[model samples]
Target: MSDRAPQPVERQLPTEEARDLLALVRELAQREIAPTAAGEEDAGHFPREVFALLSRSGLLGLVYDEEYGGGDQPYEVYLQVLEELASARLTVGLGVSVHTLACHALAAFGTKEQRAEYLPAMLGGGLLGAYCLSEPSSGSDAASLRTRAVRDGDDWVITGTKAWITHGGIADFYTVLARTGGEGARGITAFLVPGDAPGLSAAAPEHKMGMKGSPTAQVHFDGVRVPDTRRLGEEGQGFAVALSALDSGRLGIAACATGVAQAALDEALSYTAGRQQFGRPIADFQGLRFMIADMATQIEAGRALYLAAARLRDAGKPFSKEAAMAKLFCTDSAMRVTTDAVQLLGGYGYTADFPVERFMREAKVLQIVEGTNQIQRMVVARHLAGPESR
Candidate 1:
């Protein structure tokens, strides 16, 4: 096989403004987040302070419209910003992505009144938002969710349990998908359920393997009443809306995966260059050099995939298949890079003294969440098979 691999055609060279934003993100991430990530992860803590800092810096609303105190930037730029934040701390990166995904219902399909009421609090206040789609039994098969929303006069009474919800307890609002009609995906409907709605309560957070700093909980909505005005999109259109939102959300996850891989590769490069093996640095070994080469190559390819999908989104083109492909490639790459990084450090890599073990742990969750790699393959295959398969 040729040593030169196929060049990914999806590279997104950031603009000057994007570079400036990256500089700001890097500064904040290294100075503020890096110091606390380990401690918070060990204690199973959430960094509310980071949200405040991001809000004040206008980083939270980088992709939203300017009218709502947002930057209205392109997805390629926004995703790079997300990557930089995630490289420092996955919790903040995921929190930001979930918030952005939550805004999709309002931004793309909401009524003017709904957007006016909610978009500001989301983009301007850095008030976190959680997407309530996955149920206890319905994970990758999200359309089959059992959550129910019954119409009651001027309000809708929601009763269901949303599982694996990031920011479930801490979010200011939730973009909930519930069954309002009959069965299957078509029966689902979306709503903007305020976090403080009566009868809405969150269960104790789950004990996760990684991203521990970002709380995941089961939110129970027992007869939670929401104004009819809070309904997102038309009834029965919720599944489509949720799918569309997830297509973009998958891109965010892809960026996160790439960041994790990049971080792992960086750590491995630094370690191998300094740690001596047989009177020379480990990097001097040809075998380790080849491994590093593979890691760098995979990370670059993953970046290209995500950026291509992001550009498609920015251009308002069909990008669902591309998003799935990116998510699959990037997350898989992250898992491999982090694993190899740990192996490179030998025993030290397995210990807490180095962050490679943490990166390895963190990379795994990226592959499991946001429609798992298997689901992503199904999505891509369906897309490739044309409308007949779907």
Candidate 2:
């Protein structure tokens, strides 16, 4: 890895305020985040303190309401901020996104009382969160989840296992989905489950290909009780809430994909410029130069696509289709760009000695998470040609 951090993308932020925010985020990414990313990742250490610092800096809640301790920035500003953080480290960037996704059920659909009670701490109290929707058998078919939440007066007892959860064991709280009515999508309900709730236990984190610093575990809820006051939306409305949150979550993943690609491109450029091959620099070769150019172009275009979707969301317009497209295009671009980056570096790229290889590993997960690229295409296809024939 280079001793220096990657340069920030020259962002066209909407306001002077937004510009200042980006500058601060970039500075933090370079100083506090990037400097230790490789070592921490290698050690499989989760930098929870860095997330605390971000919460204190007000970066954790950039897209939520200021009344609830958030930055109240638009999605455009938030996504750009995410891109910068991701450029430094994907774990932190995607961690922030998953936190936002966990908070979304209450922020967007919770009763006003629920919002007033939980939003502040979740936004800036250094309290991390996890979202639980994917289960052992319900990855793509989220509606078919089998977790059960049975009503018992004012309390509901939840029992089932949720898999592939980020922040699974470490989160302060969880936004959980369970079946409260019957089978399928219409049967689900959303609840805010405290992390330390009785009977809530998380399996050891999975040994993953990348983002090892970010925990992915399976949480078991064995008769975990949740109060009625903690229910996020109404009974049988959890599926809608989960889908709504995912549309925005997909945009976050898109921004993260661009960030990783941007980082890979920067590393490739840095290496080629300094590495001598034919008595000069490898960058001097026309073929290599063309590869670099193509990588840069894809990164730029992916950024644009995600930002466009974000703007549509901010404008209160229907943006699900655009969000899915952005997610598909940007993640695929990240996979391609990162692979090209490795090719550009020759043998050095294949080793853990450089960040490009790490970027390549990290990019693979983005295509699979936040609705896999295959899933993103299905979503876009649904928008285009309606649902697939049963």
Candidate 3:
């Protein structure tokens, strides 16, 4: 394979500023991220310093309000930035997406005082955040969560375990959803809890198939207390808040998946172009050439699908169905593209000596996270034909 770096993607950005931003991201990814990704991931080390650097550089809050220390960029721009980061390291890209999801409840539903008091620190003050909605028993049926928050005159005592949380133990804050009333969806409420609250704790991170550098754990709230002031939205409104955040979060995953696929495709192309066999490079073979073409096509289609969904969000239109579509297609495409990359490289692809094997493992998680492909299909169907019959 060629020793040279992969070529920069040709992007049709909206403005000179966005173009400049992409250039900076590409440079940062190449210089600071790509070089050590393999080694660090192999060692299962989380690069907290890289996140600190991203925070200081104002890359952590691209889609939020500028008044509150955010970049105020459009969703289109933010998603592209995620793509660049994930191309170098999926851990960094997906971590930023989860942090953004953690911030959404407060940014969208909190009172003015809440925004002014908390937005700056969470956005750019070098603080990380986690979202807590899923429980040990409830993943897809989130409205049925059993976490409880009881009012105590001036405070609420929260008690429950949140499973599969990204940045679980290391985050500075958490966006928690708990049952504040009775029964399903209508009973839930959102709260912004400090990570150091007396009873909050995290289990050891899971040993995952890939992206081992990113921590995923179960966070426990054992009677964790928070003032009423920390409540994000009105009682019985948490499910809405969670769903709204997820609509945007799914788009972030779609972008990350596309980036992974693109990286894999680049690796395959380089390997085939340089690996000679029987008096010629493997790129000479028509079968391998067809595989490369198909991989590139899938990546392009996934990117376009995500960008379209992002544009809808940027325009203040309803984009839930499109977001689900993008997440489903892009992740599935990433899996296919990465698997093809491994096949193209023959024996080397099966070993950790090459990055395609790692990419293949990473692609599997994307399919299952941020709602599974099955959930995405259900979402798309609901949009098309209304709720399903019980």
Candidates in order have lDDT scores of 0.88, 0.94, 0.95
Q: Residue by residue across 23-123, what tens digits does model 2's lDDT show?
A: 98898899999999999999999999999999999988988999999888999999999999999999999999999999999999988888989999999
Summarize candidate 3's per-residue lDDT along 98-204 as a digit string, tens digits: 99999999999999999999999999999999999999999999988999999999999999999999999999999999999999899999999998999999999
Clashing pairs in 2: none
TM-score for predicted model 1 compared with the true structure: 0.95
lDDT of 1 by residue, 189-293 (tens): 999988888999999999887888899999999999998899999999999999889998999999988877877877787788788869988888999999999
lDDT of 1 at 189: 90
TM-score of model 2 relative to the true fold? Answer: 0.98
RMSD (Cα, Å) for all candidates, in order, is: 4.3, 1.3, 0.8
Give the runs in model 1 whose Cα sits over 4 Å from its true position: 1-14, 387-390
Among all windows of ten consecutive residues in candidate 3, which has the lowest summed lDDT? 1-10
Model 1 residue 188 lDDT score: 90
Give the higher-TM-score candidate: 1 or 3. Answer: 3
